[model samples]
Target: MTETLRPPASVRLVRIGEEHAGQRIDNFLLTQLKGVPKSHIYRILRTGQVRLNGGRIDAARRIASGDLVRIPPLQVAARTDEPPSGAVDAFAERLTPRILIDDSELLVINKPAGIAVHGGSGLVLGIIEGVRKLRPEARYLELVHRLDRDTSGCLVIAKKRSALRSLHEQFRENAVKKVYTALVTGAWNQKMRTVDAALDKNVLQGGERMVKASAAGKAAATTFRRLRAFQTATLVAAEPHTGRTHQIRVHAQFMGHPIAGDERYGLSERNRAFRQQGLRRLFLHASRLTFVHPGSGRTLTVEAPLDAELQSFLERCP
Candidate 1:
């Protein structure tokens, strides 16, 4: 029996210019078919609806100049079942103390722990989506940087593509200064320390973003300077030189001082120890962010005062 492959989606590769020369087909669609959901894109790919050079291609496949992309007719919903207007309104209601700074070009919010920066998988809402409701007229609001779901602190939002792209360039050049504060188990030998490790995804075969240390992985760097000492832990300022996935948490684990309450990269005994101290979530927070303003071009430093939970922990430390 012959394999019954679905008829390919037919599309023409139009030469817009030299700019769209090297982008993948899916990315090209994301730009071209703006406001279409990502779920729809993946669905089209799985159905063999998109073809390049008369062959099916995955979303990750890159396209070269003069290559034709055949996009199958997509069955799209006329109305996007977006989050309710009231849902967005409620989200804004909660961002009371969470706002750090806001301007025409950017928005800085103090993202709370336990919620993701943006929705992925089962998460229905995130920091960015909530912020979008406040300024619905803006063309785009992209995250300049990201923090883990359990890590809370100053999160940056760029209003326009130019600012977003420029700020990204700054991060690549290491002009952005990011500082995090964490409570780590066991410490006190080095006044300052740097953790250099390579991280690879142990991907759990199917799970997303779960990674482990591997020599074959990307180089990760994190520097730590002890700010204060505790009886069983230390409060330290962590500067991640390279923004690998879980760089700080992984480095702390490598140092044998996994962040207190970090179940994924932490020890049971240490986590239990902090649980007694009232430490709940992963004890990490983006404390400070410094960068040149994209609009004014003046040096600007923004700080998110630690939430009540972290502040109380510090005060009670003996």
Candidate 2:
């Protein structure tokens, strides 16, 4: 079945609600105008086609409750059924069983590898979309943080705006404690406790994002503890002091031991050898997270155990 979008015929003023008050205007417009191209959304904002409270507004402006947003008419092409109905339902079903915690303000899940946290970069459906489908009545659902698509483990989602803000603040202040489990290509040095390297992220001509340890990059650090060492591989626990994109993977690479099965940064020969031995995905997992509960004001800790594949592979490592 093909998906069709019917753009509104005329300009309209929409009153912002408390649930969406602090959201960026660009994000608000994306939610308001479904099926519209992302570039078009930014274009409209750049040209002042959208407004807040009868005044032109930029995309980064935070909207407030009771603010009136003017959305201009648009023409969008029909979107084909990229993700079939069966696929969407299958994703939702796969995510439902992985849910670890669900409360009035938060939803935590042991996110499975290979599924993105939210739809983007040519993906039509992701974890957030699947969760919305699971709970149709949920008024607000947003990702508090993100995990790489190939990295499985604990993920937190906010069910309310206030909760989202609080969690964001926690992350910004580096108050959230995150722990990851990883298997690297070589035995880790027990004496090396930390990798305090700065990382610079850049996108290549083909749009592939890459991160490297650079002196001019933002400060990043990760503390590592050797868990168990095999002949050629080592399992370790990593605690990141700063949240940078692919910090652990890059730091591991800088230590001459890229993560096993990390296609972008690991040794190709090592990865191929591991693949033959049944390790198919990146050997990185968000094993645990600790933070203050937004609503209860109590310390909360969540842990996701290694999946069967990872655990079995570790058993086979020698």
Candidate that scores best on TM-score: 2
lDDT of 2 by residue, 108-181 (tens): 99999998876654668778899988888988798777898999999999998899888977987899999999
Write the residue-wise lDDT of candidate 1 on 1-318 in tens digits. Answer: 111234434343343232444444655665555445655666576568777767888765656656656665554444444678788799876875688888888999999999887653345577877887777888777777678899999998888756766676687667898899998888657889888889875444333346676789989888999999988789899998876778888888888888888988899987886777777888999999899998999989999888898888777755
Weakest 10 consecutive residues of candidate 1 by summed lDDT = 1-10
Evaluate model 1: give its lDDT. 0.75
> Candidate 1 has what TM-score?
0.77
Q: Against the hidden true structure, what lDDT does model 2 obtain?
A: 0.86
lDDT of each: 0.75, 0.86
Looking at model 2, the pairs that clash are: none
Candidate 2's displacement at residue 110, Å, is 0.6
Query: In candidate 2, which residue ranges exceed 4 Å CA deviation?
Result: 1-77
